[model samples]
Target: MTALMTAELAWYATGRFYRANDGSLADYGYFLHLPFADAPLFDGKPSETSAHFTFAATPFKADGIDNGALSLGLDPVGQFSLYLQRRPGATFADPASFAQGECIATFRRTSLVVGTTVAASLTSASGAILGTNVFSARLIASNPFEFAGKLYDLAQTVGMGITQFGTAATTPVAPPPPGYDLVLPFTGSAIALGRAG
Candidate 1:
């Protein structure tokens, strides 16, 4: 388990994200889906063997940077939209902010019955083109295990990733391109069933 957690792991998460503008939620939210889980088949086979995101290394590194920013190494080209949040902020923050990144993962033991709590903060500094962004997550280990002074849990991890952008001026922008800044917020849970090669 130490090797798995310290090395690489694949996460299978089922969550939803909603787009809001001016604090008003959308009439309907959208569900998160694997990139090619339901896409056109090629050569009578699926595009990817697994839909889960593959981490090159653990996110709980001493520095908390992970093998690569979140999973930037997984898809450096950004073709899969693995980290679309970086798209608009390319100028403001490093594309691989998750690596040696501001995000921090920690584990603390509570009790055998209650389990341990795993949490991390997702954040980035101001970039040349974008302002700072913030997000966080917490996971409880219903059935906990300890390793190297750290607790490990394979239960459902729930958290939220939210960030707002655009002019904060109450007045509307010129006369086009919507009247307010864009707010992209998503909340959901992910489960780490096992590691991925």
Candidate 2:
């Protein structure tokens, strides 16, 4: 039997902001330093076959910051959605780099604003077995709140990305719009489960 490998989820998020004053776009972005996972995603034999993964998270305090301060200046899930992406040949080794492969799952909401406790979980199957030895995932949040120089009704939807486990380097889906200061990153680690082999 192949040796079992432990995996932790890592990522970085970028938020597109807007101003309620002149309908201008602003807010750069921030990184979230996540805590270690409570347990390994999988503890079974390694294989390049189909599998299901569930990713979940909550918005809360972190780094002396109370809750996620991305848009509304507070920690709120802001969006109630989850997503996954796994192409054939994906693996658990060095799973931070989400380049390209079979898309097992993906969920990005245009309008999702909810607390951590009510947040939804994402899942998907690679189908017939596919993926590398490492586990990798990508969470996309596309919600910008702030209209006419005022904080829009649910204008705090963005997370950080993780490239290396210990490295400080991370990436975002898009850069912060001009004149916008990306809000703070959210605390609380997301959940990743190896649903099946």
Model 1 has a clash total of: 5
Model 2 misplaced regions, further than 4 Å: 1-113, 116-177
How many clashes show up in model 2?
Answer: 53
User: Model 2 — TM-score against the truth?
Assistant: 0.20
Give the best candidate by lDDT. 2
Residue-level lDDT of model 1, residues 1-197, one tens digit each, is: 23223212223222111112333211111113322222221222221222122111121211123333231101011001122121122110111221221112222211111101112111221121211211122222134333335443333221211111111111221221242233222223222323223
- Which candidate number would show the highest TM-score if scored against the true structure? 2
lDDT of candidate 2 over 106-183, digit per residue (tens): 333222222221111101111212111111233343233222243311112113321221111112222333432222
lDDT of 2 at 67: 34
Q: Cα deviation in Å at residue 33, candidate 1?
A: 11
